[model samples]
Each structure stands twice: as C-alpha cells, then as structure tokens.
Target: MLQQNLYNWRLVILATAFSGASALIYELITSRILLLFFGSALTSLTIVLIIFLGGLSLGAALMTIFKKRISSTGLVFSILQLTIAFYGILILSQFINLPKLFDALAKLISSPLLLQFTGGAIFILIPTVLLGAIFPLAIAMIIDGPNDQISSRIGWLYTLDVLGSVTGAALAGFFIMPNYGHTATIVLAGSLNILAALIVFPAGKKLRLAWLIFILLFTIVAGLAIRNQKMYVIPKNLATIKDPYRQSKNIDIIGQKDILWEKASPWGVITVTEEETELGLDKILNIDNWGQCSVLSHQSESLIADGALGGKPEADVLNIGLGCGFTLASVLNNNPHQVTVAEINPVIYEAAQFFKEYTNNAIDDPKVNIIIKDGAEFLRTSQEKYDVIVIDIEHPMIAHSSPLYTIEYFRYAKEHLKTDGRVALWGYMSSDPRYLKSLVNTFKAVFDNVVFAEFEEPNYVYLFLASDGELDVKTIDTKGNAEKLLESLASIEDVAPNTLDNQILQKYFK
Candidate 1:
C-alpha cells in the first residue's frame, strides 16, 4: 500500500507540471485574441493581466475553503483539468464571434473600459479559475500519506510547475505561434490539459472506460475544429461596434476589402488590401489593421516631398518608412540625386513589388537605395548627412511607434541634418488636440523653426517642416501654400514635449 501511494504521488506531480504549462500557454494565446477586440492600449493589457491573475487567486481561495471536503483528491484534480480543457477549446472556437458580443455589450454599457472588463470576465476568468484550483488540490492528494512532508513536497511540485511554465512560454512564443498560428497554439495547450487529466484520473476500473471515452471524443472534436477553422478571419459584424472618434475606421476598411496578401510577424500582422476607391483600384498596406499608406494618394505624397525638400533639386534625401513606395515615388518624380529608404519590415519591401506600377518603378531605380533596418537606429549609425530627412511612419498611438516620436529620436535626426537642410514629419490632424500639441512640442524641442503644411483635399495629412534656421515659405513653390501652411502651424496649442523618459503622447492619447 505504501509503494502504491508513492507511485500515485509521482503521477500527480507530473500531471501538475503539465497543467501549469497548459495554463500559461492558454494565457499567451488568449491575450493575442483579446487584443483584436480591445485596441492595444496599455490599460487594456493591464486589465487582461489582472483578470487572468485574479481568476487564479480566486480559484486558490475557493480550494483552500473546501480542502476538508475534497475526499477524492485525484478525482477532483482530474475533473478540474478536464473542465479547463473543455472551456479553453470552447472559448477558442467561439473567439471569432467576440466582436459582435462586444458590440452588443457596448450598447448596454457606454463606457469602453467597463465593456472590456465585462468581456474579459466572461471569456477568460472562468477556465482560469478552474486552472488555479488544480495546484492546491494536487498538493492535497500528494500530502495524504503520513510519511509525506507537506511543505517539502509542495515546494518540489511547485518547482516543477514553474519549470513547465517557463518551457511553455518559450514554446508558445518561439515555436507554436510562429509556425502553427494562434488557433493551433490554443489546441496544443488544450491537449496538454487533457493529457494531465488522463494522468491524474482516479486509479480504478469503475470510471476508467467512461473517462477514456470522454477524452477521446473531445480530442477528435477539437482536432477537427482546429483543422477546419480559417486563420485570422475578421468577423462580418465587427463594423457594428461603433467608434465615435473614427480611430478604428481603418480596421473597418480592412474588413470590407479583399486581402491580396497577409503575413504574421513578431512585430504585427502585415496585410496588403485592394479596394475600389473614387480614384480607382487603391492598393493599401496595413500593420495590424492600422492603415500605413496607399498607392492612390500621389498628390499627397508629392506635397509631402515638396514641403520637405524645400524646392531643392537633385538633392540627397533620406526617407524613413517605405509605405507602398508612394513617398519614394513622389521624391523620384522630383529627380532626386539619391533617395535612401529605411524600412524595418522586409515583408513591406516584398509587398511593395505589387505596387511597382503605382510607384513608377521607384524600387528598381538606381538612385533609390532601400535598406531594411530600424529608422531610429539607422539615423544614429549613419555617417552621411542628408539635404532632407522625411519621417513618415505609422501613427504614434500604435504600439512600438512611440519610440520614433520621442525627443531622443528627433535629436538623432537633427544631428544628421546639414546646416541648411530641413526635416519633414507626417502626422494626421484627426487626432486629439492634446496629442497633436505634444507631437508639435516634441518637434520644436529639436528644431528652432517649424512650420506645417496641409495636404490637398480628401487627405487629412499635416506635414511638419522643421529647420535650425527660419523656414522660408517661398520654398513651398506653390502659390499661397506657404502662408496657409504657416497659419495652420500658428494655431496649434502648446503642450509638453514627448521624451524617452516621459512619453506623453502614448500616455494621454491612448
């Protein structure tokens, strides 16, 4: 009997390790899925972490309360593991419908924060609670024998659990997510939970057949569901979730158009979309449904290059962010001596091939040199100076974009500019006034004189031109364009500059 008890203890420890691994794997995948519904705000990420950890804490508390009544520890542990597997599979299968659910909840609750909290509680908390109960119950079972050192055994089991979690995090991030994608990763984690349940099921002939049949059926169903499910399909009803600020209008456009090409990278999801606009077939590039640029906006691109170059002909220009090559094409039209483009994502360069016709074959031009590297890092390390530096990146509100807009990055760009050279930064006027003020202040912190230019009709782009010396409106060349641009710049309200230590734009804008 003593030997049998020792054998059971070993099995329980192994099962707990697997359970712990599955719990962490589920957390990683679920967080990615939730980001689709709730925009990637710091507050949203914080709320998600809190919800997951809070569920675990609640589960442990409940287990402690009922420790005395849990007569069959193995049976209780097996049931909890099975339940976690069941709920994980069920939630993943229904994930595509989350946007519609959020929309319905939005109608009932006006506050976006409250709606996100409610959605998290319904989708993530329940299964995580079950997962939390598994550890304590496993401990109870292992400590049943008098010879068992409760504290030491608990420590040993916990060490195994943590080791399993570390392995799970690495696997989920590096191997499973990159190769099999999100749905498949969840399925893999769910399978681990089912395996744990089989290992910890009560050792008897009474319910062994029943448990085996249940696990088999679940595995088959889950396998088929994962195999059949389409990867990254935006729900049809997602647009019904209203955004008064129009911050998610780009997401709606992505859902409405036909996706020509899509790639999932560690940075974010890169999608090339073709949509019929008033200008005709427009090829648009997006990073995680945030519109980067389009090939249809030649006029806006021309205006941006003209304002930045300050009418300098045959000048060397540095263009950061190769978004569909619209800006590069515009620069080439002016017949620049050299145009060096720094694009961080190679996928964007590959996608640019499809838009070669729209960009006037700028990618193949001998004068245009495209380098795949981070914009800020390239600026810091480059030895050459530029006649004009154009910073046309994604909106600062997006994740990882704040770094490019910080004071440190702007100062680096300033260091690379020639004495008489100018820098042009592109931003949208559609953002909040406070956010816009913060951006303007950040630019002013680097350059002494800064002016703004508004692009032609149908495009809401605001071009910020900055220089060490006073900006000459005559450089704009277009009649009355300079005065009009400076007028827009003069109207901006003052605000604190964005720095590496204090990212006011990300904190206030989000």
Candidate 2:
C-alpha cells in the first residue's frame, strides 16, 4: 500500500506553513544581508530589491512555459529551489567579497545605477525563478483534473505566505532578532525550511525519524556557533565581562577603561564603551560609524562626542532609527530631562531589559518615553517639543530605510522644534548630491539656521545642526541629572579631545 496519491490534508497544511516560514527567512536575508559591506546605501538597497523583484517577475512569466513539462508535485522542486537559493544568498552576503564584486560589476555594467540594479538582478534570478514557479507548479500537483477548482487552496496559501512575510518583517524589525543577533535568526529561519521539507516529502518512518533528529542536532549546534559569529576580540584597557546577550567575541574591557558593551539581537547591536586614558569608567569610546566601524581609538574617534554640544531645554532631541539600547543609553544618560525616542520597531520595547545598559535604570527613568512606531510617522504626530534627539539609524543599504530620510520627514522635524531648539542629523556619502541637496533644502524650508558640519581628523560624521532662532550654546544650564552626567564627562579630564590621547564623542558618551 504505497498510497502515493493518498497523502493526508495535514501534510499540505504543514507544507504551507513551512513555505511561509521559508519565505519570511529568505526575505529577511535578502533585504538585510549586505549591510556590513554596502552600508545600506540607497544604491545598495535599490539594487538588491529591484533585482530580486525583477527576477521574480521574470520567473513568474517563465513558469507558464515550464509548468506543462514538469513532473508531479511542484512542492518538492519549489522547496529544493528555496533551499539552494537560501544558501546562495548567505554565501553572497557573508562568505564572499560582494563589495569587490559590486565594484567590478559597476565597471562592467557602465552606468552606476544600472550596475547596482544588475548586481541585485543577477542574485535575484535563482530565487525568483523558483518562487515564480511555485504557484503554477503547486496547483498542477494538488488538483486531480485540469478543470478542478483549486482557487480556494491557491488563494489561502498565497494569503498565508504574504501574511507570514509581514509577520516576519515585524518580528525581525521590532523584536526577535534584535536581541538574538542575525546568525541565530538565520538558523531559526533555516530550521523552518527543513521542517517544511520533512513534512512535505517525508519518505518513510525510519527516514523521517532520522531527519527529525538531524534537524534537532543541526539547529542546536548552528544556533550556538553563529550566535557569536559577528564578534571578535578587540584590545582595550577595561575589565571585559562576558555578556551572553551580545555574543560578541570582540568585546573587551580595558581595565577601568571603556569597553564595547554591545547587545546584539535581531534589532542590531547596541554598543557602549569608553577609553582607558579617560577612565573613571566614563570616557566614551570614539566610534566612526555605528552602522559600520565601532572601533575604539585605533581606527579613529567619534565625530560628535557624547554630550559635546551640551544639553539644554527647548532642545528638540530626535532619535531617527532607534536600535537596541545604546541610543536609549545616550538619552537616559542625560535623563530627568524630557526625552523623545522614535523607534520604528516595536520589539525594541520588549528587549529593552536584555541589555544591562538600558534595562536596569535607563528605560525606567522618569524623563524617558518612547513611541513604538515609524520615526517619520512620529515626527508628523508630535505637537509637543524636545531638547535633544538622537538619529540612531542609517538609510536603505541592504533593505529599504528610505522613508526615514525623505524630505517629508525633515520637514516634520523642523516643525516640532522650539525656535531655539536644534536638530541633530546624520548623513553619509554613499549618496548622490541630489539626495544630499534635497536634505539640505528640506531642512532649510523649515528653519532659517542650518549648519552642515563634519568632524575632522578622527571620525567622518557629517552632522547637520539646524535652528529657527538663535545659536546659543552658552545659555543652557547643566543642573540635576545633566550635572551628574557632566561631572562624569569632566572626571575623564586626562582624556583630551582631538588627539591620540582621546576622541570627542568617546570622552563624553558616558
């Protein structure tokens, strides 16, 4: 009794769920993987997405041509294709030197824009073709006759997969991954794929049992191994403590010196550290780019030293893209003052306590209140005012973070500011001049005062300080919580700014 055609309905349901999970995982890796190398530039994001989508669209078209010739059950082929595509995507993102590939492709393709688009396009063809083939192939496999009504099945499965993608995006963006790190996230996604394969094509009792055990062992081992993958050892002068949450191998303690106290979850890394010479456990470690290099003095220093500009009332503090707890750490460090942190991901609130820096007393501070919504949307909703806000996110490099930087967002930031309140804006140059000018013009529309300032020698941060009224750094009072913070900054007196001795942002962030 082979019962080849008598598979249970439960099998199909499991297939569908597995499909949803795989789809989610694939999308996450697709959208975010190249960030470390590409730095999430608009060019990088557009290339990846356009290529993937275009390939998918192309694949869907081709499936019609191939479906008639394929054998029974497109499910097997679809799952296999996805598994292959997943591995390919990971290799391109992590193992390969994609940055070099991108450069070569740029020269080969001629047009920079076209080159980027093509780069993503080339990567997209595999998954897209397979994905495109899934629908028609599945329908052909499931139904008994050419005229059979399988619309309900198709509709339900399609809807479920899309819903799952949204869920994945929300979960990864807001919660699960921010505290877990990317490798663990990937492994979780992969296990779902393996599960889908077993359920859809479970050969026999003995084989099925073996697969289950294998998967269990594989997941446990993979999770542990990749959990600490992004970490490495960095030389420092503080007392390094093992943080299970961060899973970073590079985190070091330079005696009483500041160290990388990073918390990496799906939410990205929330890192805080100080230098040795500027000890009292206070001097902030100078980090060039939070999204890229977060090295201590060896590479360079932080552009804007923490609390460098000084804190003041009517200061409109803006947190553009809130990550784990580090940005919140900066906000709470100067707390008891009214603070507004704009976080697009809801999961950040849940994992706030996972990182000791933000958990113990940081989020609990009376002055802190967070809006768990899009930073751009929150900007539109604000009628109240602020003193200082931190822009903790970057643009669409791997995925798409474009909405945060559009003219519309800048205009809203302008309106929410007190006439004297200034806005802190970060802009990177993996950019077109038009985009930069658009940003410049957008802020100019709202305020009469704007300064395009960048740090020299150590860090390369281009900070935009804008005001509608006067530029007065002298009138602000550093009393109460700010005073204590100031005292901490002052204690690292030996750590001077703009030297081999210290970094500006590094000396102040504590």
Candidate 3:
C-alpha cells in the first residue's frame, strides 16, 4: 500500500508541473489575441492579466470551500485538466468573431478599457479559473503524505510549478507562437493538459480502463476538429479600435478581407493588405492592426527627408521606422552620403519589398544600412552623429510607441546630432488639441527652433522640424506642405511636454 501511494504521489507532482506550464501558455496566447483588438498598449496586457488573475483567485477560493466534497483529489485534478483543455479550444474557435463582438460592445460602452475587460472575460475566464483550482488541489493531495517532511514536499512542488511556468513563457513567446502560429501553440497547450490528466488518473486497479480509452478517443477527435476550424484574421478596418475618434465614426468591420501577406512575430501581428484606390492598387503595412504605411502615404513620408536634409544632399541621415520604405526612399532622393535605417520589427523590413516601386527599392540601396532595433535604443547606444535624424514611427498613444515621443527620446537624438543637425518627427494630430499641443511643446522643450507643417488634404497628419540652428521652412520645401509650416508654430504654448516619466499621450488616448 505504501509503494502504490508513493507512485501515485510522484505522478501527482508531474501533473502539477504540467498544469502550471499549460496555464501560463494559455495566458500569453490569449493576451496576444487581445493585442490584435486592443493594440500593443500596456492597457491591453493589463486587461488580460486582471481577468486571468481574478478568475484564478475565484477558482482557488471555490476549491478550498469544496475540498471535502471531492472524493479523490487525483480524480478531481484529472477532470479539471480535461475541462481546461475543452474550454480553451472552445474559446479559440470563437476568436474569429471578436471584431464584430467588439464593435457591438463599443456601440453600448464608450470606454475602450471596459470593452477590453469585457472581451477578455468572454475569452479566458473559464480556462484560467480551472487552471487556478489545480494548484490548491495539488497541495492538498501532496500534504496527505506522512507529516514528517510535508513542508519539503510542498516546497518542491512549488518550485517545479514555477520552473514550468518560466519554461512555458519562454517557449510560447520566443519559439512556439512565432514558429507554429497561435492555433498550433494553443493546441499544443491543450495536448499538454490532456497528458497531465492522463498521468494523474487513479493508478492501478483504481484506474477505469474504459474511461481512459474513451477520453483518449474523444481528445483525438476534438483536436482534429480544432485544427480544421477557420483561423481568425484581423480586418483592416478594425485597426482603428484604439482611437475613440475613429471608432466613433462607426466604420463597419464585420467581414474578412483578403490578406496579401501575414506573419505572427514577437513584436505583433504583421499584415500586408492590398486595396484598390482611384490611382491604382495600394498595399498597406500594418502591425497589430494599426496601419503603419501605405503606398499613398509616400508623398507625406517624403517630407521627413525634406525637412531633415534641409537641402544638404550629402548629409548623413538616420531614418527610423521603415514603414513601406517610403521615408527611406525619400532620404535616398536627397543623395545622402550614408543612411542608417532603424526599424524595430524585422517582419516590417521583410514586407518592405512589397512596395519596391514606391520606395525606389530603398532597402537594397548601397548607401543604406538597415539595423533591426528600436530607434530610441539605437540612438542611446550608438556614438555615431548624423546631420539629419528622422522619426517616422507610429502614433504616440500606442504603449510601446509612446517611448519614442517622450522628452527623453528627443534628448537622445540631440546627443547624437552634429552641430548643425536637424530632427524631423511625424506627428499625430489628436482630436483633442491639448494632446497635440503637448506633443509640440515636448519637442520644443528639447530643441531651440521647432517648426510645424500641416497638410492641406489629410488634416490630421503633420510634421515637426526641430534644430538648435536656424532652420528655414523655405529651405526644405521639396514638397509644398512646409510652405505654410512657419505660420502654425505660434499657437502652441502653455502645455506640458510629454515625458517618459509621465505618459501624457497614452493617458489622453485612454
């Protein structure tokens, strides 16, 4: 009897470790899915973690209350594992409709935070709760051993569970999701849940052979069904969910559009979508559903190079955010002696080839050096100075992108600039004038001369030219946008600058 009990306890320990790994894997994968809807903001991650941990806490409380009712800890543990697998798969199958669901919820709830919380609960609450119950039950069963070294046993179990979680987070983020995609990663997690259940099934004569065989057959069929379901593709139109002004426009994003190219990466979901415009076919590059650049935006992007170079054709330039290679092409048009392009996402660099015509094949140019690193990080670490530094990144409201717009980032750019160097930043015109004014003030806080350029057609997009030296807007008017830029700089004052310590841009958007 002693030997059999020891064997069962060993299996329970193994099952506990597997359960820990599977739970973390589910959390990461679900958070990534939510990222496509909510964007790459910390808010998106916060909503997911809150929902997952909340459910786990509730599940643990329930398990403690009902411990006496469970006849066998091992049997109940096995059942919970199976339940999590089923629930996880069920949730994944429904992910394709998330955009429609989010839109409907947005109509009723104006708050993006509340909508994200509601969506996260819909997708992950059940599975996380089931995951939470497993740990407490494992402790109860392991403590049933001889009381002499019960503390040691519990410590070992806790250590294994934590190690398993670390492994799961590493694999899901760096290996599995990037290589096999989200569907396969979730399926793999579900398979581990099944293995955990099979391991802890009542051992020997207590094991029901019929039940074991039935579960094995059922899981195989269910796995196949999950594999065959349609994969979710985030619609191009749904990319504006984060912007309250855009979402208020009531853009219908119900149906799926044909995707030209798509890949899941550690950064986010990189998608290339083609749309027919009056001029021709325009391909758009989007990261995490936020449109980065399109062929049509090349004219606007050219202004970055125009303002930076200020007619110094041979000036060395640093261009950030590859985005369809439009700004790089514009930099090349200036005939810069050397151009270093810093782009955070490797996948975006790969997608640059799609816009070869519009970009003048900028990625393959002999004068260009492409470094796959964050623009802000590159500036801080590199000692190389440039005559012109162009910041062509995404909106400041994005959590990850917010860092690039802070006073600290401008200071770094200032450090790496030559005596007569100039910086050109692509600015987002927020619906709220306060945030827009804050951004301009932030740039002015770092440089002596700051010029603002607004486009005639796209009223929301603009450019900021900053330098310690005298920068004439007339000197860099390769395009006509800068013709009126000097007149607009007067109205921006009395606003606090957006800084790394206080994220004004992200808060305003939220």
Candidate 4:
C-alpha cells in the first residue's frame, strides 16, 4: 500500500527533494554570503538562521493561504512555479544590490541586539514561508479528485518528500555546489521547479523553449562565477551577534584547476590545490580542519614556534585546525619539530592541498604527521602530552562550539598539558567592547596565569599566554622579540582566548 503511494507521487517527490536541496544550499549560502564584508561568526550566523527560518515560516504561512484551494496536480504545479519565482527573486536580491542593502540594514539598526533580532528575522521571512507550503500543497494536488483518500496519500507523499529532502541535502552539500558553483546550483534548483511544473502540466514547445532560456541564463551566471567574481554585498563593520566574540568573514574559492571545491558551510570556503612548493623546508599540506604542513616545514627550518603550548614542544608536536597550515607553517619557520596535526574536515585538507596554496613538501619533513580528528575530543582520549598545544578554532556562530570555550573544556586542556606545557589561542577582535570582555572571561575560568597582549596592526589580536606556573610574556619582551612576536601574532586570526578577566567578561554579562 505504501509503496503504491510512493509510485504515484514519485515526480512530485523528486521535485520536492530538488526544491529542498536548493533551499538548503541557499541557507548555506545565506550563512556565509556577506562574509567578505560583514563577517563575524555570531553576526553572520544570526543573519543566516533568520533568513533561513524566516523563509521557511513564510512558506508555511503561504501554505495556509492556499489551504485546500488547489485541488488538481496542475494547479499545484502552477502555484509551485509562483513560489519558486518568489524565492528566485529573494535569493537573487542578495547578490543583486547586495552592498546597498547590506549597508542600509546596518544603518537602520543602531543596537546590535535589535539588528540581530530583526535582521535575521527579516532575511528569512520570504523563503521560510514558501518552503513550508510545498508539502501540503503537493499532497493536495496529487490526491485523486475527491474520491482519492487524501489523508493517506498525503502522509505517504510526505514520507517520500522527506526522504527526497535528505538525499538532496547530502548530494548538494557534498557534491553539487562544490563542483558546480552557486549559480549552477541555483539553476539546478530552477530546473527542478520547471521539471515539476512539466510533470504536473506537461508543457508544449513554447513553454519548453522558455525553460531552455532559463537554463541559458543559469549557464551565463555560472560562467561569471567561474571568473572568480560574485554578485555579493559589501558590508560595513562585521558585528558579532553577542558582544566581544571572535569572528572573521571572507569569500573563498571552492574549485581551481579541475576539482570540486565550493563554499561548504558556515566555516569558510574549501578548495583542493596541488602540494607543489617547498623551500627546502619539510612540510605537510593540509586544509581547513586538519593539516600538518608546518610539521614538515619546521623539520626543514628547525625553527621553534610558541602559542597554546607552555613551552616549545618536543621533537614531535600535535597541532589542531589546519587553516592553510598557517600556524603550523609559522611553527616550522621557527623550530625543527616533528609535528602531528589533527584536522576534522577532510574537504578542507583536500582544498588546502589542491585549490589553495598548500604544499605536500611540508610533510616531507621527517618530523611532521597529520591526523583528522576533533581537538577537544582528541586531547581527551590521547595518551600523549605535548609541550605546546595550539587550540586555534574560533567558530562562535555555530552553537555546538560553545562548550569548547567553556571552563569545563579548559579543565580538560589543563590535564593534557605537561606540567610546564603552554597553550596558545588566537581570536579576532574588533571595535566592540562587549565581545572582547566576554572572550577574556571565558578563558579566565580555566587557567591560572592568563596574560594578554594587543597587536598594533589595527586588527587587535588578544594573545592569551597561560600556564599553571607563573609566566610573564613581558619577561620575554627584551629588545624587539616581544614586539616582533606581537606583530606577527596580530596578523594571525581565528581564536578563542581561555584567559578571561572577570571585569572584561562582566562588560558583556547580561
């Protein structure tokens, strides 16, 4: 019986899934879209969620408006066309006059709280409303007239739709956009819309030609994106959703040469480039979440770098967050350490190696090793202790990470450090006082001696130098060593400091 219904609504099922995938891709895009300009984890996340659910909600409400009004499959497809058209406009608007719209939104909201609450809500309203409507309308259209067992058929259709949604998301996230680019993905969604309409009301030659025209339009958009150009908004100062949190925003290319690399998620862009360069420095090429490029580089350079670790690590060091292998690369330039780095996202590693400027020659260092895993979890289970542990993940907008910065996580970090080990953490800070203070407080709860430094590069990097023993970076500041380190540290972003001050933390306290 159930299988029969699935057979009946198969076309609609496919269409819904296609639509669902398109919706999700847009949601991912929404989260990271304005990044290059207005990017802060919290702020960007707030906007992304608001726009996403808002559109979903809007879709739901519109479904209520059409409740029981459309009886035939033909009518439903017609409405689907209208809904897609509406979503198309809203989606395109972000890329179209994006800079102006972004600035205007920024201007009207004087309060961060207000801006976050309203801005997020507004951006999502349109699509949420539309996405919400599809399922019910689809069922109504598919029912076999009044004689059709509407309720049972609807339930069965829903099951198929849900399955389709799941499949669509997996395919789009893992494959489609990464290889195809945003414009192509949208066109893909639009094609689904046109397909659904045809199934419900098979179009004649003229209508088919019109659909062909749209495919062409989508092709043109894809070509433009290929040139590394995008129709995106230029934002004002990127604000954090909550005051005093670390953040960054920038557009990343997904594919270069002939690989599948596109914006993956809220984290950032992912690309796969070849590991081609090594200046006689051994290095391991890696990408976003996992990398050990520096271990390789350092083995060759024989230089020592310091951060989260209390002291320079032993010959072999373990690293976290393979961000272009920068921190590790910096380490290699300073010391000759056999480094083992753990990264969570393989896609990131792939991109760093292929699309971005990562080099395999780094791993050529006899001392470097790469592991893919989560930092906190890896630290918990591993029997190894490092002289220097660098925790450089600063993703605040994604809610799951809050615990990593909590005092509880710090306790775990302490346990992993050797008696005299060091921990280095870097975070992005801007003009917001509220966010900066909260960051300090979050760190203070776990460590005993937490000291901070302000870098002068205009991008203020709060360097939290912490350990159980008494250590003052000020002591290391003799001639220009402190200043130079501070200068370099200032340039490095992506952090969450565990040495928060009560006063600083209280500034943003509710």
Query: How would you encode candidate 1's per-residue C-alpha lDDT over 4-88 as one tens digit per residue?
Result: 2533777788888898889889888777777665655455577778998999999999998887776677777778888887777
Clashing pairs in 3: none
Where is model 3 more than 4 Å wrong at Cα? 1-7, 203-256, 277-280, 456-459, 474-494
lDDT of each: 0.75, 0.50, 0.75, 0.51
Candidate 3 lDDT over residue span 401-499, tens digit each: 788899999999999899979999876666665676677788889999987666532335767788999887654444565544434544655567899
Determine which window of 10 residues in candidate 3 has minimal summed lDDT: 243-252
TM-scores of the candidates are 0.83, 0.61, 0.86, 0.67
Distance from true location, Cα of 29 in model 1, Å: 2.8
TM-score of decoy 2: 0.61
Global Cα RMSD, each model: 7.0, 11.3, 7.0, 10.7
Where does candidate 2 have its weakest 10-residue lDDT segment?
498-507
Q: Which stretches of candidate 4 lie over 4 Å from their true place?
A: 1-14, 32-54, 63-76, 82-97, 113-124, 145-148, 177-181, 202-266, 270-316, 322-326, 329-337, 344-363, 395-404, 430-441, 475-510
The residue-by-residue lDDT of candidate 2 on 145-181, one tens digit each, is 2343456656666766577567766765565555566
